[model samples]
Target: MVSRGCCPAKIGELTLWWKGPLWLHKEDADWPKKKNIYCQADEALLEARTVSHVLSTVKYDLSIVEKYSSLLKLLRVIALCRRFMHNASKKERLSGALQAGEIDKAESSIIRLVQASSFTSEIQDLCKSSQVSPKSVLLRLRPFLDKNNLIRVSGRLGNASTLNESQQHPIILPAKGVFTKLIFIYWHDNLMHGGQQAVLSAVRQKYWPLNGRNIARHVVHRCVKCFKYRPAVVKPIMGDLPEARVRPAQAFKKTGVDFAGPFIIKSSLRRNALLNKAYACLFFALLLKQGT
Candidate 1:
């Protein structure tokens, strides 16, 4: 213990995470070991793929206003004129119902898939069910939040949402990304915490949403020397037996010769005349030894 903070050992342990033991629950303890599905960056990769495909495909449209037009092409010109009508010359003006129109048929012009995919019940259901707007909840949640915590949820009808898995939510568990090690630290004593802390510790010493002193307690406890020498507090909570370890039993046999020399009262079997002799010497040897 010192004026600045409590230091357990001589050099004192390096402070690893700023949000220490209290943040212990979220920061160090909650990380998972296996590859999380969300980590595939599917949202990002899919967006990239869509952009590339669209760019590559855009150049191939026959788009010229000619007498010959495929059914899809006919609708495409009508829709394109409507989409760009505000930018088009006055005579080329067309209705802009494609996006604002409540009817799904408005988009039948652009792509064959759009019209086909509209029939998919799943997509229609998704559009109607998204009643929760981000502003309503975020506004109320913002007042309750302090400097340390932040809550954000943004998902449009057809877009992916954004959530930081770094902070684990009690109800909604974000997928755990890749982690370093998995060590179970009993929550009570806060012993044996591992994984993400080992990873994040490299980045910062003190993190936000927490005070200064508490951070030191966690960092010092995890240091190599301090952890090895930290006195084991074997109080309750550790149930009766360790119960996690097991071993097998075996047998051994030995045979050896030995000499017995002694000086003591005569044995009941000894009716020898020299009962007062200074010492008695006797030898017994084992012939063999075996184990069944």
Candidate 2:
């Protein structure tokens, strides 16, 4: 019997072994069973392993990653397994919220997981060194770890007494993250399908997503109601009038008539005579001078 160093990972009753770069599932089958079992990485192992270890374990060539048009999609795939593990491990920190049917808490947990996985490098740098690299995208945000270990914008609003924690130091999130997009969608819906600027403003109240404007624009753009109700673009110049409408014509050929108000009239110019109503009709002739 071949002995493995680490114990196999049990995920939702399924035992999976991570040998080298492949994930092998250990299942009971009718076929001959071998005493040798494969052991895989679990949530604990995943956290124990460093970035270099995980990177080394990846067997795919650069071509596979290059096939993806957007880097965000690639990042999502890499973080998928970790995300699943976190959700499954919800019993630790998020179990109560999940059991209580608190959707807001569950969403917050998911967001926290997203940040932990996506911004691992930045988080590590902030925790270990207390400073982010200049080359990092988060450099401009002046990011710092909050009480919850979540990265937040270290802006100049720290002294504002009226502003809340979220308002003074909003959570930092990647604009391209799926959860981030979902947040934008939530705000868009909550704001009664507002415009991009309005959604962005609402989002900034609690979270600050990188490239937030673009993300908000994308969310608003995808709203079917907004697209349907959007105003049509008006041309600056007027369209050319039809030849029949502008061409010169004979007098009264393209004429218009209007009637003036009724005037009281007297018969035989006598003040006591019977009064009659009379209306005067006026006619407008197009190209009247040319025809005359």
Index of the highest-lDDT prediction: 2
In angstroms, give how far residue 275 of model 1 lies from its true place.
Answer: 69
| Residue-pair clashes per candidate | 2, 1
Q: Evaluate residue 2 in candidate 1 and report its C-alpha lDDT on the 0 to 100 scale.
A: 40
Q: Give each model a TM-score.
A: 0.13, 0.52
RMSD of each: 39.1, 17.6
True-structure RMSD for candidate 2: 17.6
Measured on C-alpha atoms, candidate 1 has an lDDT of 0.32
Model 2 Cα lDDT, one tens digit per residue, 158-239: 9999999999999998766666776777788889998899999999999999999999988888888898898789889889
Task: Give the 10-residue window scoring lowest on summed lDDT in candidate 1.
Answer: 176-185
In order, what lDDT does every prediction score? 0.32, 0.69
Clashing pairs in 2: 18-40
Q: Residue 79 deviation, candidate 2, in Å?
A: 21
